[model samples]
Target: MNAPVFRRVLALLGDLRLAILLLLVIAIASIAGTVIEQGQSLSFYQTNYPEDPALFGFLSWRVLLALGLDHVYRTPWYLTLLVLFGASLIACTFSRQVPALTTAQRWQYYQEPRQFTKLALSTTIPQGSLKELATALSAKGYRVWQTDNQLYARKGMVGRIGPIVVHASMILILLGGILGALTGFMAQELIPSGETFHLQHIIQAGPLARIPQHWSVKVNRFWIDYTDAGDIDQFYSDLSVLDAEGQEVKRGTIHVNQPLKYGGVTLYQADWSIAAIRFRLNNSPVLQLPMAQLDTEGKGRLWGTWLPTKPDLSEGISLIARDLQGTVLIYSPKGEFLTSLRTGMSTEINGVTLTLVELVGSTGLQIKADPGIPLFYAGFALLMAGVIMSYVSHSQVWGLQEKDLLYVGGRTNRAQLAFEQELVAIARELASQSQTAEVQA
Candidate 1:
């Protein structure tokens, strides 16, 4: 109702404690999803957990639908956590750290006369008598400013700014990541060989939105290479370029590391599949085999009938199908006979000549487009920079001038002990310089 109440509500929502708690919960839930397997059908979960009532109940379709655990990052609650984390970082920047930075940046040298006079490292030098001390301080890279009544000095100011740069980078990165998660879309499609298709709606966006109406892509060819040991070493695809108007322009290939780009959209080589297979009866005429290829429609093209050039049927035959699902087809050369078969399944025909045995299939093409990718990447770089600056830096200084003294101190978000050591060193340097200046003056 009031601004104060609203601010307080926002502050509580953006608290680091709440963020940490949400992060932990999200992490645990993510691990559970991975362990239990996500996207599994209700029947699968039920089958796996048939004997465990608790697991069955927890993994029930109703529970998953209610909690949105099936799609964690996209789920409303998970997205809410991300929003909260971003708000917390923003609040921390404005509320707790900005003032601290201002004080540290504008830090000035100050101390009481009595405090300096009672110090173990104080010295009383004649006026205009500390030129050599100034030279030594200058050599150590301190910016020295002085009047007859007082002195002002600053050192490592640029170095001090490093932390700020790093922090700003982190905030930039966080904001970028949040923006991307909110606005970006990444989708994949598998086009079997001989099939023609265009980019459709993205199924993977955290929130479903119309895919960029301006974007679309098509896969022309896909290939894979394997080591002698049967390990995959590389994968790639040749793609036909298409505009939203369905016009063909450029055609090129892309590998796992290299992606094809067109009109601000990038198509990645995601996967492959068996497009089709060809089989002709043995003892059949060469003419009977006919032309077996994929047509523009992506369907298997076969021209000719089961009747063979040979008048007599000879021996039984084999048809081997390949791909994830190996469905085979067997037929006789001379007669009207055809039968269906699957991988690892075979039959003995009395007189069937399955001569030209062939295997075929299409490569599944995967497409993706996300305008926020660059922003997300830039944000990643900035966030890391901020974290390093916040944690690894140390800032401090001390001064002794006749009857007056000053101590200035500040530190990075990390390594307080190292910061204290640095503070002690600066103090020692000033104290030692004072003692030497008094002796010479």
Candidate 2:
């Protein structure tokens, strides 16, 4: 590139206004992503955003799909914005923050007494010795440098480096977000107790996702705790991670808000359902029947099973259960209420004694694997440290002695009033200690 063109490019990258505008755009995009719901199926959008009367009078499912709003973070445009913002941060940090910090670190000596008068806070003490002044400034935490009759000091130079740290942390956070959007995945699975499964029902996955194939999970057991009033208090699932050889590598009992983690995958207990039942007929082997949920049309959730009691399949009984409270309602095939039985109880229908053994429950689990969470946490730590460092004021002081006339001046980039008060205190202390000291500006 030509010299002028390169300079223009650098100018644009370092432009504060451009950086702010990009940040605003990213914020707006993030808000939209949060509100619109990402990674949903096409049917979902079509159902929610019908065509007849579109959202906002013009925006519909078609528009949403056309603009890639279904997955904003993974879309090329949003990723491009992140890349551009990161470039801006790099350019600004290198071209502005670093150089400014370097300039702040290099000390400059005031060679002339007249230079002291230009400071916002300047004074002259007639009887104060240079040794006393230097010692006083050093005691106040200033990094002092002295030469025969001239001295220079500064403090809080870390303030100059704080902006660079803040920018670097923001860049790290943005990179983490981008990495997560490109390499993470989420899925859901429901497995009955004693059944094994793997990551199969993926709801959302990034392009570079590494789907787990060599590992499987088994639901060892699932149970629920009920309160006194017969309401559910909590549910737990004992899960075990199995390797390719079916060897258990990890195990944990996970509940709501408590998740199990293994090999970077986290499994959360999200839901539960009645899966099946174990029962026995008179003088026969135990049999298990898979239970199916019944549709109540928004009334309540119920599970049911039908058992045939006759040889020719002519007569049968129906069983319905609402919860694991251990009570089941039995009804005749002709829609007559028969009787209610609890777990470990038996009933006779058509000369066949049916014993209710146990109800098999399944655990609903949500699985997620995010590789960038550590980076995000580290970035926030740096950002907080940088914010505190930025609060310190970069203060500077200069002193000179020209033929017994002591010239002193000090200033700071921040906390100007406090710096002025500090100067007053130093002047007062010097005056109190020296009998011949006279203070003047």
Please list the C-alpha lDDT of all candidates, in the order they appear. 0.54, 0.89
lDDT of 2 by residue, 216-330 (tens): 9999999999999988999999999999999999999999999999998899999989998888889678889888999999898899998889878888999898887778899
lDDT tens per residue, model 1, 290-385: 223324365533322232324563443333232323445545544444676654343435554443333344454445555556766776676666
**In TM-score terms, which candidate is top?**
2
Can you tell me which runs of candidate 1 are displaced by over 4 Å?
1-3, 10-15, 29-52, 115-134, 156-181, 206-208, 212-216, 224-235, 244-250, 279-318, 323-358, 391-394, 398-400, 403-441
Q: What C-alpha lDDT does candidate 1 achieve relative to the native structure?
A: 0.54
